[model samples]
Target: MATVAHEILSHIYSRIVSPQVKELRKYTAFSNNVYGELLPTFVSRIFKELELSSHQVFFDLGSGVGNCVLQAALETGCESYGCEIMENAAELADKQAVEFQERLKLWGIKAGSVTLITGDFLKIEEIGEILKKTNLVLVNNYAFDAELNGNLVNMFLDLREGTKIVSLKSFVPPGHNITAHNVESPINLLKVDEREFFTGSVSWTDAPGKYYISTIDRSRITKFLNSQE
Candidate 1:
């Protein structure tokens, strides 16, 4: 089933998305923020790993061109949302989304609803509300600076328990110890697991790299508070 979905997504990208991107690139210059992409096959694997279902909600922060967002909707039938700050990338994402919907109809597939927003994800009020119920989030933060990543962590503090966040860079350091002085830190509420991906998993590089899945689990915080009592 996953293989078939991958084939279909590849076809859709080839037919509906690639041409639009090529045309857009001719007129627009993509900013450094608009750098990486999660390939269709890799994204499918991520959906499976995260156990995304029809009832779940998926969000892609800094979603470049909405490829991962479109794939999520088609593969899992989950409510999909993407926010891109780059104007040129956001414009292309909107065009790709329109074509993606049309192509889905042509293929006779029923996909989940897709919403693509153009703005700073941190400032988006709707995203804050959505995070409360979001099942999974993807952030390609390989090139993100420390300040931006810290801001993302602050925003993630609002995510409901059990929400899974996948990222190219780990939010919580390895063997992060929760202590009295920093017991209130957001990192205490997360359980992070690391995994590796081989070459061709992403658009930025050909070498193998690692990724992190941080699950929102406030049990650690609760346990710590209980211990204090």
Candidate 2:
């Protein structure tokens, strides 16, 4: 039997979202670091891997048009939040969110709450508060610069233990080591797992790439401290 979520989301993509995306492509040209999208299949895989559920809260940093946010809410019944800094993209996301709500009524299906915020995620005080309670966070940091990635790491420091963060680029460097000198670094608190995504998983490129799942484990810091003692 086809799940209610699958049926509704299929209809929404074919009827509601596809046309808007087509129209958007006519005028909008995305540049590096400004926009990218993960396909629905890829997102579904992520939800499965993370075991997302109704009891959790999901956040998307640098969300482009709220695709992942909408999917997370409707499919998992998890409260979903997305923040987009680009004005045009944010406006489109707002419109899509409105339509998404109305369409859910037509299907007589209930979905989790969705909140779309338009602003610099790093500067948004409300987002900081929400992050403390968020169970999972997604950031499409494929094109993000080192400075921006560093800033994101600082923000992740406040995430609760066991919170998982998904990103296109690994926040913790490949060869990172927690020595006494850098014991205070936020990287020390994360345990990252790298995964491969084949071509067509993302909108930016046609080649295969890697993504990372970073779980906040304060125990790492504790272990380091205990070793010192």
Candidate 3:
């Protein structure tokens, strides 16, 4: 029944507003990338892997059209927030969010747990505070440039202990130049806990793409302190 509701919402959004996003495609060209929607199945699997709960807060950075955010809200009853840089995508997400709120009774989901913000996520003043409270953070940074990815890694450094961050791409590639940057690690205080590979549908493409899930290791601090002794 929950799966049916999820699919229904996906279909409704796609039928109503997916076509209008074409105007927004030009914006992605500047970044040498395109905004791709994740399949509901892939998102469902991710939520299952993480074991989200209503007690937790979830965030989807670079969230396009709020699919993952809405899904998380529906699946776990958790507070879900999504940040998208594109105006059209954000507007569409907000409109759909209103629809979701109106249909919450029919869907048997809680209200007021989803929010869609339109702007550069990096510029959000309270981003760090919000992330600190977040139990799970998801980022589809497959198209993000090195600068943006680096900034995102720095942002992760501010997260509370044991915060889980799942990304579609590695923030710190192998053999990153730490000496040149004068940072102990590519991500400063965060260490990759574990990485898992999965293939799933993205955007309108039928081909499945590989993704990575990583977490911030708070114990890295303790390990560092002990090494000094």
- lDDT (10s digit) by residue, model 2, range 1-229: 1266656656655665566665445433434345668877788889999999999999999887788888999989999999988776777788778878988888787889999999999899999999999999999988788888899999998899999999999999898878899998888888999999888898768888899999999887888789999
Measured on C-alpha atoms, candidate 3 has an lDDT of 0.75
lDDT of each: 0.84, 0.85, 0.75
The C-alpha TM-scores of every prediction are: 0.91, 0.90, 0.86
| 56-93: candidate 1 lDDT, tens digit per residue | 99999999788899889888999999999877778778
Ranking by TM-score: 1, 2, 3
The regions of model 1 sitting more than 4 angstroms off are 15-34
Error of 2 at 207 (Å): 2.3
Q: After superposition, how far is residue 38 of candidate 1 from its true place, in Å?
A: 0.9
For candidate 2, what is the TM-score? 0.90
Worst 10 residues of 3 by lDDT: 177-186
